[model samples]
Target chain A: MIERNGLQSGSQDPAPEGALLPVVQVGRPADVPRGRADAARNRARVLDAAQALFAERGVQAVTMDDVARAAGVGKGTLYRGFGDRAGLAMALLDDRARAFQAAVLDGPAPLGPGAPADDRLVAFVLAYFRFQADHLELVLESEAGRGPGARLAKGSYRFWRQHVAWLLQEAGAPHAGTRAEVLLGALAADQVRHWLVVVGRPADAVAAELAAVARSLLR
Target chain B: MIERNGLQSGSQDPAPEGALLPVVQVGRPADVPRGRADAARNRARVLDAAQALFAERGVQAVTMDDVARAAGVGKGTLYRGFGDRAGLAMALLDDRARAFQAAVLDGPAPLGPGAPADDRLVAFVLAYFRFQADHLELVLESEAGRGPGARLAKGSYRFWRQHVAWLLQEAGAPHAGTRAEVLLGALAADQVRHWLVVVGRPADAVAAELAAVARSLLR
Candidate 1:
């Protein structure tokens, strides 16, 4: 079932051309070779254990040995699967990211296709923040050394940009592409985590602010 | 005179705020501390040499020895005055950065203070891109290790944000703060360089698009 992440959503509308997350990109989909049931199962088990342990102790404090032990897998398999902690973090992000793209692409409204463009825009912001909150530590660590503007080149980033641009165009907004990029800047992972965690602002306040920004821009 | 950056041909009104290039921000405005004319002269000469060398060879390729030789200063003076190559890069950036801030802060109509808010906003985008173009290599080098987001916390960044927010409010734009931040995102050093160099979009085209976005938003 998880393998279906590689498959498109039921949307008649196609995903962007050539947008499968690059193998080098964080959270590239699980392109596990078919018929590797055992490999897939082991992979999932490791991820589940890794997520629990990392969330319990935080990403920095958790060791690979601990994850392998908890997953009941050989250390060799852990290394072979995820390569290192950064790789593991990216893999976990990949799983959640894939699920998110699917849900938004086809799951349900107002996040899916059925809601008004304005509502979908707000819903996307709220949903994206929650995702950022859940993976705060992972994202901050994983993105180290990638320059700030560098994230713009990511497949996931492009996807969200396209989504926002489409909605802006739907509402007859001028300069939708540039506006979408600016709007999307508000949701940068580094900035979001800083506001939520460092500044200790509740997620609700930030969401309210973003929704307000969207309303102002889209109005 | 520096004041000329502010006064336009038709404007009877002078520019706003005490906005001259501060001596401290770039070179501490001749902190000669009395009876130190020789030291000031050497400092000025070194900076002139550094500016020309950096512009010619790019930041990375130039070395401390090259600067010292070019300026006819002893190596000790160069190190004592600017610390190292990185220090020199920053000092050079500071010089230009201060000039830019001054010009926009109080120079002439449009960018300075006398123009309408919307014109100021458009003029700002155009002027900022030109500034970025002038110091692209210096900025990229000077701002390294400061995460792209980290630049947001700098004093210079705060000043720009405040300026933009003030203008947005003057025009009765809602969410002025958030909108200002999003607007400023397009001017980030990393992203600006990427857009200008990587995407190969002409600065004028990008500026026009941004002007259109601002127009739509403010309307």
Candidate 2:
């Protein structure tokens, strides 16, 4: 579902002509053609177990032992699939990121591609805030210890900036790319989480204000 | 200096039809004396020490012991003076907050009193981002654990929100108070720190984008 949505959403770039899309494909030369049925099943089991454990005990508290037992797989199999906690966490975030990408890119108008730029931007920011609220610990852990939200990759960050940039361009921003990068930078996941979650305001309310701010900032 | 600026700025609503100037104390509460010179001097020394230590080690790493040593005061004296590290941090934030309040409320035109509502709002948001950058650690720690930023009452979160609310009302927002609350809620110190310090954007750039966004949202 996510893949289908991702592809459709990816096409929403009304770039002037032939602008390259920014998705980072990590699979490469040494990669095998495909996983066997059993391997795929194990992967799914591990992911399900990891998500449940993370939700219950938080990302920091859930251990590989806990995951192995919950998934009904041996510790060795679990390690083989995800290597370590960070790897498992990253895998989970990847699933979410892909899901989120699909929602914004292809799910519907407004959040997707069919609506006006201003409305789309508002929808996307709202969606982003909702996602952050739902996975607060996961997102915070992903970016913690090195300073809040320090580990999010540049490419991932660019994805958001690009989304905002597209909207800004649609909004007739004087400098779409640069302005999008700057404006969206202010509405980061950690920032939203801090305000709506940490600071105890309703997430939807803050998201609405953020959307309004985005509207104001863009052209 | 701040009192001088407050009178000069006149940026805020006139002080409730001759509400005694902050300088003209109408009443004094029990336990808190009208003023004490020695206590004020000690407070200044401790704050100066905290500022110096903050510059050297940043917010996270500095300890109360370090603060005491830097200030050439005993640990007990430090505690007596500021209660705890959190208290000390809040005091520092208070210093900046008070300065900011004076600047925005009374310092000069545009940010203070003389400019159009739109221009003042833009300047205020931009000034806010700059303030967050200047005191990143204290700002983050203030909103650190969870819930409302109640712990950091020493800072300008409430004040900023109220100011924005007033501006929104002046700019013709229906339910201006609620709108301002949402707007200020959208721009917490944690979010600004996450973007500027953690995400590595220049403060000025973030300010400009935010100012633009504020303009658009208000419009």
Candidate 3:
């Protein structure tokens, strides 16, 4: 609802927004493909429509009804499928977040697991920015309402923080836990958003510099 | 203007309502203080009133009339002195920003200019948190659009970024410029605001960790 100082004439509060989805996982779901095909297709349709709407009108301007109409679905179907706007946003993050986790966990050596921590940290940072460059709007959407992505994913940030702490431990430093928290906090999504979007800094350069800075900490 | 989301709020873009301050410098005169003793007292009364009103009701809720009434001054005099709400907010930032700058630039060796770059980096970060600890609200206010403290002096970040980059260079890594940007960007005010206010992390602990992270990066 924050308005720009100069836009007095255009000033207005935001819409009747409510959080729909549970962003953080309360419990682990089994790996069974439980979703019906029709549901999956409808979900895809809604997401596609929502992405287009978001790009054109912004995350704040678009409503659930708008999304349903864009997807050629009834409003009930849209709500049934995703619960609400926040839920829809969370669903969008599911695939990307998993893929990101997998990339760091098992994809390749540097960004995965085989390389040195310093090099892996660099690769991870570069990959993070690369993902951000590709999926800026989607990533930002999940961050709405200080919702799920705002918190530590038990398996995600904890894993990375542990990795960083281990690296610092290997480097023979004290306060590894605190150091990990600091590193993760510094490398947070908000920082990425500000740098890439608000400050208009080039992503590749930022990634390189982030990596270098990470190296400096460990070296 | 931005009312609660439950209301089908008529696009009350709260952006311009709360922050009415113009982005211009204020109150300088060619002659000696133009205001008589009474005028000086009135100005002080207005400032005190503004701060109290802002504290009781957020910056958004307090109107110029409210400020004028609280200060026991005419609304016209208030406007003459402050121009607008945004200008008044900026005025508040003046003393705070100077103190913050001094804490970084001249307070003590670790945070000041004389220590090793690595230690200085740690010191600067801790100092940033200390500033936040004392003036969280002002810090937050200045961060939003065209708030009083937004237009920081030239190279405000440069001083810290260069310090970090120079540390990297001293550690036999030459191209530290972009790295410095990333480092500084990661730890900038916006990120701090999210961490301290939204995420609810303890500023003191985060500050300590930040210093540790800086040390790890430079060590």
Candidate 4:
């Protein structure tokens, strides 16, 4: 297991700490004990339930009690697993971010490996826009009041910045570092929400526009 | 005088409300009363003193008492005018923003009118980057805890967005609306602080790169 750093000290996820790393089953073997296996199942169920509830009714409208009820778990169990609403939101985003990272790291071409840098960059922007569109509320909740630069501290943000910079460098783009930050800045959750909810732009249209802009920057 | 809208209801500036409009001296004739003239002079002194102290010692390091002393105004007069540190910062930003807006509206060539759209956009980005660099700390303080999308509500932000959108439209860029938001997102004060402070990049480098990217989008 990777050693937990002070950066994620605020995290209450029961899972392993490294944000970009795969969630490792450290001690559990194939012959897992019944109670431990049950706990894992319960965690998955709770997450699924929370995701559905949040998507259906919005994050603010759903409470811990509601999450517990939807998950078929007691309030005590829910509280023990995820300390609060913020903790649950963080955990949920952590889960999705890890999966997304995995796809970018090892999945198909363009978003993954074995594609031209410009194409990969375009794919990455489109995928990230969709990710933000899907989880805009949760991302906002997970990031709220953490100060403006808090996102820069996230492992996921650092990973994305590095990946984008790498792609731009591979594409021989000048000022890759600053350009990566500018590209990611466009995907900031609050800005996405403003475009989607406040501005009432269609998600596909916004995402396509951003993708086009990303491709243009590489040119 | 324009009616004070609820959008700037939070504003504490004693000056007239419209952010883009020049500060009109309502009811003050050419031959103004000595007392009112002195009050205007004192206000200018306070703002000037605050700006210098903030630049020299950083916004957080300086206090209202220092501003009062530096401006040679009483603490009571300072507090009565500005309400608190935040209020003072807002007023300071408002003063600067108005001046910047004026430059954009009427000042010479690239930054003002009578230039190609692409050249105007590049100038706007460079000027905005310099503006953020000069006032990073105060902008951060004034915007703290106001929410992620709070900047969108600012009259100055709206004005800039419209101006950028107009430029993009004139330049025949597709999705000018979304592109304008993307361009302005790069100039978000928090992101600018990250680039200038956390990333330790020179303001000129960052500004130039952004200007280049802005020019690219118009192509």
TM-score per model over all chains:
0.71, 0.63, 0.62, 0.72
Please list the residue runs of candidate 3 whose C-alpha ends up more than 4 Å from where it truly belongs after superposition: A1-45, A55-65, A68-87, A114-116, A144-174, A193-202, B1-50, B57-91, B103-110, B113-119, B144-175, B182-206
Which prediction has the highest TM-score against the true structure?
4
Per-residue lDDT of B119-174 in model 4, one digit per residue for the tens? 88889999988988888888776555344576675555677888999999999888
Candidate 1 per-residue lDDT over residues B1-219, each given as its tens digit: 122221121011111211222322432433324434565566667778887888798776787789899999999877666544544555666546766787787779899889999888888888887887668887665544443245554445567878888888888777677677767776666667866887788888877887766665564
Please report, as a value between 0 and 1, the fraction of native contacts recovered by candidate 1: 0.48
Model 3: how far residue A218 lies from native, Å:
2.5
lDDT of each: 0.66, 0.61, 0.58, 0.74
True contacts kept of 4: 0.62
iRMS values in order, in angstroms?
2.9, 5.5, 5.9, 1.3
The local distance difference test score of model 4 is: 0.74
Docking class of 1: acceptable
Candidate 2: interface RMSD equals 5.5
Provide the DockQ value for model 2: 0.15
Ranking by TM-score: 4, 1, 2, 3
State the lDDT of candidate 3 residue by residue for A103-180, as single tens digits: 676778888878877677777767766775676665555443332223243234556677678866765556666555
Give candidate 1 misplaced runs (Cα > 4 Å).
Answer: A1-88, A198-200, B1-29, B32-89, B146-148
